[model samples]
Target: MTFEVFMQQLANGISIGSLYALLAIGYTMVYGILRLINFAHGDIFMMSAYFMVFGMVTFGLPWYVSAAIVIVAAVALGVLIEKAAYKSLRDAPRMSIMISAIGVSFLLENLATYLFTGVPKGFPDIDILTRAISFGNVSLSVATVVTPVVTIILLFVVLFITNKTKIGMAMRAVSKDFETARLMGININRVISTTFVIGSALAAVGAILWGSKYPSVIPLMGVMPGLKCFIAAVLGGIGNTTGAVLGGFILGMSEIMLVSFLPSLTGYRDAIAFIILIIVLIVKPTGLLGEKVTDKV
Candidate 1:
């Protein structure tokens, strides 16, 4: 491939990787706190996309307005899921919470189908994000260039928040030992709620960026992305946010480069994430940057 072609592909990889990174952060955060996968997280993303569509297309709102609305809706939905489904199950077995998460996922999917009729909706075209632009020899859309930048900025923001803030300290303490943190006067519920709020908001942002690139919305739209992001989280260390971001970039780059180098493997792109997951599990279960955490026996 030519240099320009390589650059284009790199841009594509970064854009998709950024979205994966955003979603993967959500997975890692929740898992770090509760050790639950939050299977419904993907559906929350899908629902956010629909909220965008309705806000922009149905209500004649602007893109920024729609996006704000989507974020608020996603945050609300995430907190609701935590309260209605997860909070009550706090004292229950791990398997029970997992089951609840799965049920919530199904409920969101079905509810979206009932409301949106499963007909794929076109994502509104925002000229600013979708407009074509040139960078030296690289020609791409604004979103392509913006995505990685956004991801990097957000990464720093999240890292700073988790590393510098008081709530972040509480989160770290809780992740290490829930009961101990509570004994230290950390409100477990508040920290968990904050995690969900941040995670779901990130999901909304990812969904908006996804719309810019893919430009189609459907009830099942989030399923594959959700699964892959989860895999990305696992590949990076499920409870480590930075690792999740790193894993996302790796998966995104690998998938795109695979298609670029081996056309025959293009159809097998999705399989790559799973293969990486398997390799990570076998080679390093704690993930590349993951710390080993042992339960007190």
Candidate 2:
């Protein structure tokens, strides 16, 4: 491809990558604290879109108002899921928690299907997001340009919260030793709930941007992105926030470039994530930036 085309594709990749990074951060944070895969995370992402639809179409609310409500609802739903599904299983076997997570995912999917039906809904158009801006030979959507910038800003905010804040310190303590932290006076439930709230809010942001780009909402919408973001999390070092961002960019660029350079493989776009996951597992299971941890006997 020519330089201009390459640049355009690169921009597209970065835009999509930003969304992946946002979603991956949530996965990494939950794993960092709970060591739970949270299979329902993607379902939460999917639910955000439906929330937006209801806020806008069903309730006839303004865009900004609808978005704010969706985000709050996402946070509340995430906390509820944690409380209802995962909390009781905390002392149970890891397998039980995993099964519960998967069950929650399916339950949300089926619930959404029943409420919204299996048919897809078109994401409402926002004028600013749909508009295109040109930079000499290359042109891009407003959402494409805004997404990466927003992602970067949010990344720094998250890093600051995790590294510099008091709660962040508690989170670190819990991640290192849950029992020790609990004994030391840290409120374990509060920290976990905060993590879920942040992660779900990020998912809401991603859902908005994703709907802007793809312009479709469905019950199963989060499955592909959810799985891909999980792979991105693993690729970046499962519990490392920074690594999740890096993995997201790399995965996004690779997928975009693949389709751009070879149109024939466009159909296999989803397969790319699995292929990368396998490669990452075989070559560097700890991930590019993930540290190797040895379990104590």
Candidate 3:
């Protein structure tokens, strides 16, 4: 491939990677705190896309305004899901809680299908966002350049909040041991809700960026990204926040470069994740930066 073509492919990979990073953060954070898979998280991402469309078409809002509204609604929905479904299973066995999460995923997917129809909807075109800029011989989408910067900034902000604040400490305690944290005066519900909100907000950002890049919305839209990001979280070490972002970039670029360099591999892109997942499981289950974890007897 030519230098320009390679650069363009790299650019595409970075933009896609940034989206994966954003989505992976949500999955990682939720798992870190609750040890729950949150199968519904992907569908929540899908719902946010529809929410954006609804805000734009039904309420006649500007792109930015509609995007914000959709994010807020998604955040609220995430909290509600935790309260209505996950909360009840907090004291139950891990398997039961995970099953409930899976159920919620199905419920949301079917509900979205019923409400919006299984047909895909096109995202509204915003001229500025779609416009591409040229730098020397390299062509780049404005969204492509902007997406990673935004994602990095958000990652730092989240890291700061989780590392330097009181609530962050409480969240850590809860993640370590919910019952002990509760006994130590941390309000379980409040911390859990905050975790859900933050995770959901990140998912919304991913949804918006993904919708912008792909320009299509559907009930199952989040499935692939969600699953990929989930794998990324695992690859980076499930409970490690920073690892998730790094893993996301790796997965995103790998997928893109695979298709770019090996055009014949286009049809096997999804399988690549499964293969990587299996390799990671066998080779370095703790991930690149993951620490060895042990269960107390």
- For each candidate, the alpha-carbon lDDT, in order, equals 0.93, 0.94, 0.88
lDDT of 3: 0.88
Q: After best superposition, candidate 3 residue 182: deviation in angstroms?
A: 1.5
Q: Could you give candidate 2's per-residue lDDT for residues 107-191 as a string of tens digits?
A: 9999999999999998877768889999899999999999999999999999999999999999999988888899999999999
lDDT leaderboard ranking: 2, 1, 3
Looking at candidate 3, the ten consecutive residues that score lowest on lDDT are: 288-297
Model 2 stretches astray by more than 4 angstroms: none
CA RMSD per model (angstroms)? 1.0, 1.0, 1.2
Clashes per model (N, Cα, C within 3 A): 0, 0, 0
For candidate 2, what is the lDDT?
Answer: 0.94
What is the C-alpha lDDT profile of model 3 across 1-297, one tens digit per residue? 999999999999989888888988888888888888988889889999898888887788999998889889999999999999999889888899999998999899899999999999987765567788998899887889889998899999889978999889888898888778999999888888998999899998888877778899988898888899999888988888899998889898999999999999999999888888899999999887777765533
